[model samples]
Target: MSSAHYDCTLSLTDFCSKETERVCKLICLITSTGTEMLSPTGFVVLSVALGFIMTFGFVNNFVVLLLFCKFKTLRTPVNMLLLNISISDMLVCVFGTTLSFASSIKGRWLLGRIGCSWYGFVNSCFGIVSLISLVILSYDRYSTLTVCNNNRWPDYRKPLVAVCCSWVYSLIWTVPPLLGWSSYDLEGAGTSCSVSWKVRTAQSHAYIICLFIFCLVHYAASDICM
Candidate 1:
């Protein structure tokens, strides 16, 4: 190649390298600063909201539990389902909402990958248990109006079985992500974590679809029909 042309080509190469390095450094800076995704004011707002939810939820559910424990009349079969719902809600506030509230206060997730996984799994499990308990409560109310007394199961046994089944059903859906059907990651302003809903892989897609249909739609439809 001619000398002039070689020099021009070398200049172009150097320019490209510098530009690439600058871009990479910019990306690194953005990623390193967690507050870039959410303004400090926004984080404060989230923290306030989550803190309110955690406090009110914990106190309200705790009251219900206390009442249930203190009173014999409140221990009826129908009330058992309500107790189960209260238990799950209290746990979610403790294990799930509290972590998110703390992260929101700092404007970032502090628990790393393992904490994110725990937050996702624990929240999902307890949230679903609460949802299923509501559905069961609805069914119990409906059955009381429509079904004969002879068709109903024994009082305490039925609610006890349902409470157990709600936990099991929640486990069935939430455990798959831990086993690699999908995974958990930070989401929504980087302060909270849950199932990686943005993943487009076939496995992740399938799990999300099944989770939506079985855990969400099925329960909602059943409740509506009942």
Candidate 2:
């Protein structure tokens, strides 16, 4: 090749390299300053909303638990499922909602990467547990009604088994993301994290589809059928 052509090629490559580096830096700056995505008023509104949820959820669930503990009659099999739902929701308020509330007040995720993962996993676990518990509770109530109509006593052992199964079923769905079936990342104005639903890979898509079908669709169908 001619010297002029060789020199021109080197200059072009250098220019492209510099441009790429500059672009990378710009991208990093934008990502690192994610808190700016929301306005001050937006943060305040989010904080107030989350604060109300945290306060009311904790208080109401705690009241239910207190009543459960204080009274012997509330310990029936059907109410046992209610107790499970309350426990999951109360824990979600404690382990999940509190962190989101704090981050909303600060206008950013304070826990960093590991904390984000923890937040996502814990919330998903408890949330799914509550959902499955509700489904079981519905079925239990329906069964109770049928049994009452037939003048038969409901089996006590089934509700206990159902409660255990709900937790196990929740773990089955929520734990796969931690193991790389998908991931947990900051979502929605960078204030919180959950399942990486926006990911476009086959693995992520499969996980989301399965979760939707098994958890969400199942919940909906159960409620409708009941």
Instruction: Encode model 2's per-residue lDDT on 1-226: one tens digit a residue.
Output: 3222222223344434765665444444445443235778998999999899999999999999999999988888789889999999999999988999999988878999999999999999999999888888888778767765553665579888988999999999999989989999888767888998777899999999999999999798988899
Q: lDDT of each prediction vs. the true structure?
A: 0.86, 0.84
TM-score of each: 0.84, 0.82
What lDDT does candidate 1 reach at residue 213?
100
TM-score of 1: 0.84
Weakest 10 consecutive residues of candidate 2 by summed lDDT: 1-10
Give the number of the best model, judged by TM-score: 1
- State model 1's lDDT: 0.86
Superposed model 1: Cα runs more than 4 Å off: 1-36, 150-154
Superposed by TM-score, candidate 1 places the C-alpha of residue 56 at a distance from the truth, in angstroms, of: 0.4
Candidate 1's displacement at residue 101, Å, is 0.7
**Per-residue lDDT of candidate 1, residues 119-208 (tens digit):** 999999999999999999999999889877973444698889999999999999999898899988878788788898887799999999
